[model samples]
Target: MEKHGAETYGELNADVYDEWHDIDPTDAVAFLAQLVEEGPAGPVLELAVGTGRVTIPLAAEGIDLRGVDASEAMVARMRAKPGGDRIPVTIGDMADVDPGTDDRFAMVFVVFSTFFFLMTQEEQVRCFANAARRLLPGGRFVLECPTPDVARYDREQRVEAHQVGVDHVRLTTVRHDPVGQRFLGQHVLITNNGIRLAPAFMRYAWPSELDLMARLAGLESVGRWGGWRGEPFTGEGNYVTVYEKPATPAS
Candidate 1:
């Protein structure tokens, strides 16, 4: 897949994007903790934890934390942060990741849009299989991906604009190719001083496709929600899925 050889956007604009979406982990601590209650501050693995957006804060929670991302540039950028030094991160593809030997995690997570980075259906399934392999018996794998049917793009074009700081604002327009089902186009970061355009692209998978992948990985979906707040998995609600490893059966 192109994702393997492609330059990651996070690595390129780490500094700029981090400044914009500096979500407080403390704010979502309760939410994430609720998702992986079984993990209980045990080994927690975060996949594609770029720029420490969630890993930094999760580490602060005092849990055993490990993160992995495909882009070394992004990993290096994350390492440069205040708490980033503390989190052990591996630079490699999320699919078929091995965090450590003899240290399987109680919970594995792929947050934000990280799941979409896998451009191919097979690779996405492989990622699930890999996560399952890294989990302890009865451990849980939590995932968050936007429901594919939420909004269909006629030609697939949308713009997102947000203020990064007092004077800087980033405007991104995602253009999808209907034929190839690939994300493409340009993201323009405009400031009072000037404007910089960065090209962006990705491939997105449907929720059903993800389900098949999880099933092939020996995971069963036990929970679904709209948002982190535990909203019902309506067609409109974002897809939040929980897959569990089979518990060691009593002898």
Candidate 2:
């Protein structure tokens, strides 16, 4: 396992990210917008806000959103997009970067399994601490990721077709380390032009582990959903978990 930093993900995937990983964000945006609107009054902070995929649209909906990412290339691409420059983005590691001196957000979020990108429990805990630090008292910290499906692997390795088209095919190969609860994934893209490889490594955490992490950061569980649309979480599929910092007691 080669050591890769947080910037490695964006460096490898930024160019083709939107094309290869585009998802209809209608439901997610609606859910987040409503969450922000109904939560404590403050701005929102997004960790790993790649290419402004969700930030741009959420900002367009009149939510004050700020973002942080490790990759300058990804941020540059984001800046080129419509309304991208308007959203304040800091180029730094999400786990350690301070949002600002006086900045406190109503909500802080890391979506699409981005929390696993930290690759270690220490880093993940730091990220939770950072989110909690940036949040206002009683503010929410939300995260979304798919549950680890260990059954999908054979002998700790698996190859699956992600997408196939008339002129292009995308395949993902993964080697799982059950001991570490980590997966090293290599995405191969084959097209008429050529072949390209993009690698990503993640340390997957169980829902219980995530809840413990949040609690360690002084956050309390508020809600958990199986999907972005407020569906019940049945310990399967993707999940969105929300936690809230306790409000300060009056003096």
lDDT for each candidate structure: 0.73, 0.90
Clashes of 2: 0
Model 2 alpha-carbon miss at residue 221, Å: 0.3
lDDT of 2 by residue, 129-170 (tens): 888878888799999998999999999999999889999899
What digit string (tens of lDDT, one per residue) describes model 1 on residues 1-251? 34434346666666666665565555355667665665534588888878887788777767778887777778888889899998888777788667755678888888766687776667787889999888888888888776654264554677777547788777877776655556765668777889887655566776777778878888877787786777787866456778888876333
lDDT value, candidate 1, whole model: 0.73
List the pairs of residues colliding in candidate 1.
none
Evaluate model 2: give its TM-score. Answer: 0.94
Q: How far off is residue 175 in model 1, in Å?
A: 2.2
TM-scores, in order shown? 0.83, 0.94
Residue 228 of model 1 has an lDDT of 72
Error of 1 at 5 (Å): 3.2
Worst 10 residues of 2 by lDDT: 93-102
Quick one: best lDDT, which candidate? 2
